[model samples]
Target: MGATGTMNDAWLTLREVRAGDRVAVLSPSWAAPAHYPQVHEQAMDRLRERLGLEPVEFPTTRRTTTPRERAADVNAAFADPSIRAILSTIGGDDQITMTPYLDARPVRADPKPFLGFSDNTNLLSWLAYHRVPAVHGGSTQISIGPGPAPHPLHLDSLRLALSGGDHVLEVPTQISEVGHRWDHPRALTDRPESYPAEPWSWAGPSRAVTGRLWGGCLEILSWVLAVGRFVRPVEEYQGGVLLLETSEELPSPHEVYRMLRLLGERGLLAAFDALVWGRPIVDDERMVPDPVVASRARAAYREQVLRAVAEYHEDMVVVQDVDCGHTLPQHLLPFGEQITVDGVNQRVTAHFRRAPRP
Candidate 1:
């Protein structure tokens, strides 16, 4: 495996998947599949019926195991030639713990597309640090299983990630931050209620900026930065487009600002020419139950994010409230591939081709 920051020109090769290609579905973080077998099964069924791909599960896919054990499953998945791609059952809090146990040899030897977000950001960052490209969002448990069917926007992006192509992202008119309880029988048949989605907010210059994509769930990224193993030299991120989103955990806007402030202090903030902020889940409806409060919280998050960015580079291109991350109808981003953030035209284009080697 190449040293951190040394393999800037080479990115993981992403092969287009055929209809019957086998995809490893692993729970590298929490075993949500074990807890909600019904939901997991439905997600698997959709993976077959909707995507026409076979879902392969490892011994630990539905079981909560030690970090090393989880790493072993990830390693086995990557080393298996039959597995064309890897998908997470869901994201959890401790994926960062499993990172050190992952062996880079298989990942470097056979780089396949891995789709996940939230806590899965740990693995995504690990892959990026090792020069292995993957997708930023696609939780089988969240995106596929919970609702009546997969979100159209998510399905489109997942197809693009698996089949390989350039796609301009579509913004959904309605979005949902919370879904029905997994244990509820209605979760399988009913669609979660959604509200009118705010149009994506763009700031800075009107010109377009294009670069390779980086960043993920802000909380998980804080853990990644603290561990310092997955991060390359700050210069390695120069000109890359930063992708950021908060999870359903709904950290305060101050917390969001602090995380970005830390990135600025580390010189990581200024390295990116553009930043794409995923639509944030302001408050859990179950907890707050007030749309007005959720609306205000969302605004504060946007304010803090912009304040942090202004502190470092006020002219940096910033696009917020994108339909990615914790929000329902999420779009998967090509983690280590090129993306064009067109502020002038207000569009985001993702390039899905295998990155060239130097």
Candidate 2:
């Protein structure tokens, strides 16, 4: 379906974020990575300096164990009429713990752009349950990291998420191929060797298929599944564009396949019309042993996804490496916005029919 109603699938007509918007920042679930503090400060600076939006930070922005406290902050942010949006500094591990405490009534009454990736999947999936569409990418720390500013893809998606549009985001032609030790003493200046960008590949038809974009960090989703907190659960996701990426934790290929198999078991894999797999974030310190282990990871993922589709979904199309999550130059995805995937033509485009930029 292209689009049926203004508030129906994808909800194309609403502008979730605006210029001069006041956003409250909170630590939705897990604590930020070691470099997170610097990343957070700099990212907020960019939003104010470049985007001209005001960011409000809650006391739990750095707290992970305090799920209730974090949930309270979210409640405050959503209930505050002055704050137009709520942005997670970045994703954490156990945000699903906050779901029981969230007052979904106020959120549904006035939905705003809630952005984050990785562990923040908790909020995105939770909001989706309440019919509050969230923008699935862009975190104050990761998206606006200390690199050369918002990596182009990072900026493009964030702008689109905050502003909305019909546009193409360029993948990183040159990529940060390695990871840094954030908690280590010498993280500020230690940069990794750069890797050249390869064009994105596809495994589906060239014609475009529009659907409300869904899915998030794969591990996060697994956790959400473990906690039984999907929006409407597996069946509600039929005909959606499913996007997934792995974190720096570097779960093994076996672990990845196991998770996919579990989703397959849940009848989730067969539900989506299309699948977009992000380039797994490969980190050295994670002791993954293989710097370019992405190849193995890709092979394993393909096998699992294909198995799930073969068993459950035959017509399902797949797209790999569209560049979202854990990777540098992260792109913002509309959690419930309509997106058109042009796989066969060797291009993937996301179109938005939102209000004009502020």
Candidate 3:
């Protein structure tokens, strides 16, 4: 199950951050901060107060800019010795365009934890290709700004990501698919409405599987695979753990199936020993307001996922509806670190390693 001459051959651990260290908060994709300055400011405050880290912004951090400009900012953050970590303001649809402009030298020379999700998968995958381990979730806008405070689980995992330690992923009792619009005043002070989360559904043998992590938002990953620049050979993923989640854009169940089917066709799906499917955001109060319809949609998503898994790798351990991805109370999974999926006890333990000084 070892890979050679591929991204998995040598994974670099990121240097952990300390309190009062400077962290670059950039807009590598959409400048959500530009449109919602108040929310962004609130998120900055929380970053300092909760994590004790000073937030620093680059030129494009709060403004819409070209992909090249965004990539320049990211490069600058990585090149700077004072910046211990980097966080994206939010994710957007066009981060894939930033790939060509990104300078891998800076990231490889000084690997610091880069935390983000959704379209930031573009950056995460690029970092992974260069052997730098990153974090898969932790958008400042969605994770820290909108809620009354950062969700405890999110904050805890984020803290561990920045520092260093082992964390057992917890299944949240309640989850929210939608939050108040940043334009709404209550978005600043109130927690989003939530409902009881469905218990995680497990499929496969009652055995434990441990491996390095790969994968991200399913739609963005499809784009990554199509682009074919950041992805490695399918064999590179053998015995690795695959993480998949959908966004609020809500691709249909058939689309989900097609994506997995494409992966299967590419020999990607069967390469992993286990898969962790994040809980999908099925209900949008303003869109699909009917709870019954939302429930059915959720079930259909699970069915399609299992359908694909069975087709590709029947013995692969799968645990769906875990609190990750588009849902609130998300857990920031380490993108290239070792994680254990114990199907017998149904627990996920993430092993976060502290980087050795270069």
Best by TM-score: 3
- Per-residue lDDT for 1-358 in model 2, tens only? 2212322444324455777888887778665733357656766788888878898987777655577888899998888878877887777667787888989777766667788888888888777766567887777765564554566667777777776677665677665534455454333344444565545656644556677777788888888788775546565677778888788787866787788778778887777788877876655454233535655555666666566666766676777666776766566777877776776665666765455544
Identify the superior model by lDDT, candidate 1 or candidate 2: 1
Q: On residues 1-358, what C-alpha lDDT tens digit does candidate 1 reach at each position?
A: 4454532477767777778889999999999989999999999999999999999999999888999999999999999989989999889898888888899998888788999999999999999988888999898998899868988888999998888898899889888878888999978988788777778889998989989899999998999999999888888898889999998888889989999999999998899999999989876666223667667777898899999999998888999989888878888899988899999999999988753322
Better of 1 and 2 by TM-score: 1
Worst 10 residues of 2 by lDDT: 1-10
User: In what order do the candidates fall by TM-score, top score first?
Assistant: 3, 1, 2
Clash pairs, model 1 backbone: none
Candidate 3 residue pairs that clash = none
TM-score of 3: 0.96
Collision pairs in model 2: 205-344, 206-344, 206-345
- Global Cα RMSD, each model: 2.4, 3.8, 2.1
Q: Highest lDDT, which number?
A: 3
lDDT of 3: 0.88
